[model samples]
Target: MLVRIVKMSFEPSKIEEFLANFETVKTKIRSFEGCNFLELYRDQNNTNIFFTYSYWNAEEDLENYRHSELFKSVWSKTKPLFNAKPEAWSVDKIASLK
Candidate 1:
């Protein structure tokens, strides 16, 4: 399995707008092929800072999602709200406890 993590900082005032967009697509994203899980997380001290953790069957699956219209539109709308460039990474997991 593949694990993907994205850390992002959004403009304080646009946090809700960003989250609303996320809500629109979260289910579609989760149900996509090769997707095992999707979740959102926020910083305890900084409300505008967020992280997303997702599980995929492989990087190629995520790439397919990235190339889709849903991702394109959501990312387009969400990009303008960024306070800083987002940080993302994909890892190949060798083991899992659960």
Candidate 2:
């Protein structure tokens, strides 16, 4: 499995907007082809910082989603809310307990 993690820091004023947008699209994202799981996390000490942790069948599947119209639409709205450049990582699962 491929593990994808994205770290995003948003402008304080845009956090609610981002959460609302995510609510509207989370299901779509989770159901995308080869997507095994999806989740959003917030930094405990930094409320404006968030992360997305997901599992994909493969890198190709993730790429396909990234290039899809769904991604384009979501990103168009999301990119502007950022206070810092977003960071992402794609890695192989080394082990898991559940």
Candidate 3:
């Protein structure tokens, strides 16, 4: 499995609009091929900052989604709300004792 996290900082006034757009397409995203699970988060101390934590089948799977039209439309709407460049990370899972 692959783990991905993205941190985005949004303009104060644009957060709500950004969230609205995300809501519109979130269902489609959650059902996309290769997706395992997905979630969203907001920084408690930094109200304008948000993050998305997701699991994918593989790096290429996530890449396919990134290059899809669904991503294009969602990103185009979300990008305009940014206060700074978004950051993302991809990681491989490690074995657990359980």
Candidate 4:
């Protein structure tokens, strides 16, 4: 499985817009091909900072999703809300308790 983590920092004024957009698109994203799981997290100390954690069947599946129309649509609405360039990582899970 491939674990994908994306850290996004949004302009404070745009946080609600980002969250609303995520709410509308998250289910579609989670149901996309090869997607095993999806979650959203917010930084306790910094409300504008958020992270997306997801599991995919493989890197190829992830790449496919990234290139899909769903992604482009979601990203177009999301890109302008960011206060900083997002950071992402695709990694193999090394260990997990549950």
Please identify model 3 stretches exceeding 4 Å from their true place: 95-98
Model 3 lDDT per residue over 14-56, tens place:
9999888888888899899999889999999999999999999
lDDT of 1: 0.93
- Clashing residue pairs in all predictions, respectively, total 0, 0, 0, 0
Best candidate per TM-score, number? 4
Clash pairs detected, candidate 1: none
Tell me the tens digit of each residue's lDDT in model 4 across 23-78.
99999999999999999999999999999999999999999999999999999999
lDDT (C-alpha) at residue 40 in model 4: 100
Q: Where does candidate 1 stray beyond 4 Å?
A: none
TM-score of each: 0.93, 0.98, 0.94, 0.98
Candidate 3 collision pairs: none
Query: Residue 15 of model 2: what lDDT?
Result: 99
Give model 4's TM-score versus the native structure.
0.98
Tens-digit lDDT string for candidate 1 (1-98): 88999999999999999999999989998998889999999999999999999999988999998898978888999899999999999987787796
Tell how far residue 28 is off in model 2, in angstroms: 0.2
Task: At residue 88, give the lDDT of candidate 2.
Answer: 100
Q: What does each candidate score in C-alpha RMSD?
A: 1.2, 0.7, 1.5, 0.5
Error of 1 at 54 (Å): 0.5
